[model samples]
Target: MMKKPNTAQTILSVASCKMTRAILRKTGRGGTAIPGIVAMKAAKNILAAVSEGMEIVVVTGTNGKTTSCNMIEHALTSGGHECLLNKSGANMLHGMAADLIAAADWLGKPQYPYAVLECDEAALKLVVPYIRPKVIVVTNLFSDQVDRYGGVQNVLQEIRTGVERSPESVLVLNADEPLSASLARSTPNKVVWYGLEASVGTQGNVDLADAGACPECGGEYAYDYHTYAHLGGFRCPRCGYRRKDPDVAVISVDKKGTDGSTIHLQCDGVIQKVRISLPAVYNIYNAAAAIAATKALGLPAQEAIDSLSSVQSSFGRLETFSLNGNRVQMILVKNPAGCNQAFSYVTGTGEDYSAVLCLNNRTGDGHDISWIESADYEKLCADPHLKKIYAAGDCREELYARLRKAGASEERMERVSDYHALVEQLKEEGHPVFLLPNYTSMMELRQAMTQATGNREFWE
Candidate 1:
């Protein structure tokens, strides 16, 4: 039998939020179990008192939590305010607690002027009471982790409970996402909605992957233009329900190839332009959401914009690395809509590269890989530069079968059982590997790579 970790060592090690976050992510067992156990025990002896006049901001979404949290923290820190943050994609109850405990002084005092945390939707219900965030930012609600969350509605309700508990907190929502926009409907708090202008997208039949119905009326919502899957300008036909005119709106978006995007927005009556390093319309909204929430906390618009432009991809979300002399991208794909956005963004450019689609049956990535079938594999497989396909992980066979059903030829595919072996093979071939990994599989693969390369820098 394996021995449990030491209680004091675990708690003390978690003091550096960054180090604790990496330990939890690289500890294995689905990144949601052991660290959580340690955190639950750690929080018992580490209760903290909120400093006077300090603000607490909590950011949550199916995707973009890490990047959003990083941006928010960067803005606050750049503006000369001390910030306690979880920038390593640790968002569960234990991870959140570990971040807080790590941020605490030696005497267990929270010395920061503000705290910004990214929260896992399911974990929010359990941690919100302990953290009592004064500002809650809802990025977007998407179908992810069906096994743990049950479904999208359940995840929404879980986050809603957290938001309702801090009913006095400033609720900043994505006006583009129906579920996120509907969060403050019954709550008695300052609700501020944010979004992008309809003119930014092509004015036609907006291409949407899923969730086009109104959350309030279950009515078919009409879209002025869809910037990305299930996100854009939409209004309900039956109840006259529509996108709330945002207090902060992304008025324009200009793409700059791989460098990033420059977004012009009207935030709190101020017209400001923010440039972000990540591509895709989704990231624009992520930057916009961060700006809106931070603005409410009195952070300057220019500082927020500057911090956003300097941000990089958080781990597997789009973290690019040099592979075989070519820049390879890692865009996480789990559900239908997210897969579609990643697919659309990559394929929309008409550039092609080899791909490694790693899927797993781990708890954090959803034990059932049935959701992968809902993804648009046909479109993904047909891209011209897709030189090869590599599948590995707990559900490798299942993903292999799915790709075969999608008409992938045997000559174009390979399945390696070991992650380290796969990395070695990729390095030998010298071709860019566009890794499409599910949650835990991605972390496991990275852990293996980090160990093999002896480089903690890339893993960060």
Candidate 2:
């Protein structure tokens, strides 16, 4: 049997690994890739470091993992709890180890009072056993990274396994996801479900992320209302299984893009208004999930709401910036579900808009742009507010072809292979440019923007 590493040895191993990552991070070469590989080895080296009852919380899903995790961390800290997080958007084993290493005390102990991790679905299958978190949050399951994960069900099963294995942990789920909601029904762990409800100003029509089928009986599901995606009031027709009323719900949501909101929320009937800077109804859902998780931790509803409105996007999740006298909004789009929500947010406002859509096929971006076709491109092309579409990054031709099918004029589409060139073109135009970029493309453009303008806002 392999001997567990000692504290000094473990610290040394982590230090060495982080040093290597630091060197890579400085190279202008995609060094963030190494964290995924190094995290597992670091975990092995630090096998003896973790103790029981550590209060570790892990957040995972195709979308909202980063945003949700960020909210959790913020709330936890707001309650005066020290927490450790993989803030670099790592999610894999090596990246997780790096985060732990960075947060460790001088004595090689992780000084944070609690641990919160955002785990990639496939990575969670391997890392959960090692970490054994006290809380696991599955944000939502959708057809994400099909090239890497095969299918949504496959990733769902992997997450189910992770939650099942950690029976002692609390499972926080997106009750609207058919698979995630069903897992809550069968899992041995204590389960907490969060979802939106039908109401005025909410989506009456389902967005593409809607999973509108019964996971148990393959029966059709009914919706009282539809939020951006498959989330909202839902019930399976055959099994009569329905979306449970959420313990926490955003009762009244008022958002003005680039502006903020006064969100009225109710936690099991207690109501309060939350002041938040993040715009978009999708963010309200994100906030609702965070509030639910905090309530699960036993904090008062008002406390969660107070902290939630103060939280900001960690990076490229609805982060806004001023660039070339224009308000630039960056929304990360990796899967069809997320892409659809993004498209809806931009087009629904009925404001004339121009956008720079960046795509990349790197391992981080999943090498499969085919899912872009599955997105609701018709929302963009048919919207009278949309003026121009500039496609950049890998597979621009494919993206152009797909957008064309949805009514985008061939004359309005401009393809640019370089990030710098795209930014220059964006600067020449004075309209708000909604930048939709996948993982790697976001980072590439982030670096270019940082170099040219000394601002991280363009990528944030």
For residues 66-125, write the lDDT of model 2, one tens digit per residue.
888888888888888877767777667666766666566534466777777888887776
TM-scores of all candidate predictions against the true structure: 0.86, 0.91
For each candidate, the alpha-carbon lDDT, in order, equals 0.71, 0.72
lDDT of 1 by residue, 1-460 (tens): 1122344644453454435455656763223334445544554433233222347888987877777787788888877888887765667766566556556654445678798888888777666665667888888888777777788778888888877777668888988887767786767878767788865443223445446467677888887767666777788879888888887788888663555788777875778667788887677777887778877676676677778877767777777766445666778777767776676666655455678888887766777778777777777777776778998888889999998887788999998788877777777655556778877787777766556554354324
- Mind sharing the TM-score for model 1? 0.86
Off by over 4 Å in 1: 1-54, 199-216, 270-273, 428-431, 451-460
Q: Which sections of candidate 2 miss by over 4 Å? A: 1-4, 26-53, 199-216, 457-460
